[model samples]
Target: MSRDLFRQAAKERQTLFNAWLMLNNPLALELAGEAGWDCVTLDQQHGAGGNETLLACLTAAKAAGLPAIVRVANNDPGLVGRALDAGAQGIMCPLINNVEEAEAFVRAVKYPPRGLRSWGPYRAKIGYSGDYFTEANDFTIACPQVETKGALDQLDEILSLEGVDMVCFGPNDLSVALTGRLDIWAKEVQEAMTEVLKKAREKSVMTLIFCNDADFAKPRIEEGWDIVAVGTDAGWLSSAAEATRAAVSPGS
Candidate 1:
């Protein structure tokens, strides 16, 4: 199987830098890869992206030799399986409220015995894994989001699931879960985040942190976050647009 960049990074205990692409733009995926992000996610949940768009993004990521991670809308096994068949190297399912949900995410991403991930990787893993059926199961990474009070309480059990390879902390959703806000640094939100990180660390599982600013990423890295995605494709383009507009505005 082709070496999954994200998995190798996690296995090596290397910090991974991910860039979110909510635009569903293949070019943007390619651009992010070219710009040196370790991996990229096709943010389907809020990305106005569906299966077709995600497939294109996956192809772009593959062309760039970067792993394409798709953030699905919910903990649906069917969606997860389809994404894997569509060539996504990894999957990030959101709103996983408990260990059962976490396990379901695993069932969706992994093969039988591990979990019933119906036999259909299509041809996505053919060239990548050499033997689509056997090798594909071993290499695909399953990441579930821990973003609720229920998830927080069951963090340990969730981490104990063998099929779950990584847990991504959704700061926005976590903050909402804790205090009904999306502020990442809010006191309550920060506490919840620390708890998740602590639990993941204790279980020896990798964790992903989302940062809005480049500067804010350092502290999370120091705190031992295994994966840190610094904002989204839309955020990057919007920031650049605002800057350009400001430069040509009356203030200049």
Candidate 2:
């Protein structure tokens, strides 16, 4: 299998950057991949696409030589297996509340004693690398999102689990779980984030976080996050449109 560039960067403590794809357009993903994002994640959890679109997006990423990660809508093993078989380089499962959930998420992405993923690398083999089954277990990445109060409570245990390559912080969901509001900067949320980052470092697990843009992510990188996902393709489109409108308008 091809080396997991993101994982390599994380090991070296380098700040790997990723682009978010919430839209179902393959062309947009292809463009984003070509634009040089270290990785591009397809947000199936909250995004508009399904299995078919995910396969297309993965194909597009491969064509641009970019690694593709899929944020699965749930922790279902079949769904996770399908994404891997379809050529996704990584799987990000959301709302993992404890070590058991984290273990299940890891099992779904890995093969054999390491995991329960059924054997089948259809497009993954042809598109990604050779000796698919042999090297896939080591090449694929499994990231469980730390987005709930329960997860934050057991952050260390979750990060210390075997086969878990990294953990992502979903500030929006975390804020809601803590204060019943979507304030990413809430004191409780920030504290939980700090704790997770510190524990991940102690355990030698990689850290990832979703930020609104580079500006929002800059400080977090300094705080020790290995990978940071910037703005979504949808957000970028809207921002560009708004900027163009402002530039052409003469008077308010």
Candidate 3:
């Protein structure tokens, strides 16, 4: 296949830097891909787009020689298969609260024997090796978000499931679940995240965290997170616009 750099990075124990796309803009996705990000993920869950937009963005990312991933709206196997068939190299499922959900998410990405994904690699075969079908199971990454109090409680079980390659933390939702607030740095949230990180490492499962910036992610990286999404395209664009406005209208 196309080398599966994300998986390779995980295997080599490297911290992969990823970009999040929420604006449904192909040009923005292409720019982010070319800007040296290890991977770019389309946010289908909370982002303003759907399958059509995701496909276009995936194409843009591939043109820039970047691996594209999709965070499906939910843990539905059908949604997972569609993303894979549309050429996504990885899938991130939201609110995975138990081992069953985790297993189902993994099964949807992999083919039978290893999973229950129906055979359909329409766009997935173009740039990949001739043996795409036979090798796709290994190349595809399946990550489930541990974002709620219930998911946190079952973190160990979820990570232990076969075919679950990585576990990503959604701090915003987790913070609310833990403290009824949005402070990701709250003591309770941090403690829970620390436990999750420790358990993931113990099981050899790759870990991912969403950070607002590099500074926010540095400590987590040092804490052994395998991947960190720096920020969303929408957030960056908005921030730049605000900075420009501030510079021009200092007193306003």
Q: Rate the local accuracy (lDDT) of all candidates.
A: 0.83, 0.86, 0.86
* Residue pairs that clash (backbone atoms under 3 angstroms), model 3: none
Q: Report the error of model 1 at residue 11, Å.
A: 3.3
Model 3 Cα lDDT, one tens digit per residue, 1-90 = 667777678778898888898996889987886788888888999898777888898888878887877999998888999989989988
Question: Which candidate gets the maximum lDDT versus the true structure?
Answer: 2
State the lDDT of candidate 2 residue by residue for 68-140, as single tens digits: 8899999999889999999888899999988898998999999998888999788898855568888887788
Once fitted onto the true fold, the runs of candidate 3 whose alpha carbons sit more than 4 angstroms away are 250-252
- Per-candidate count of clashing residue pairs (backbone under 3 Å): 1, 0, 0
Q: How does residue 214 of candidate 1 score in lDDT? A: 81
What TM-score against the true fold does each predicted structure earn?
0.94, 0.95, 0.95
lDDT: the better of candidates 2 and 3? 2
The predicted structure with the larger lDDT, 1 or 2, is 2
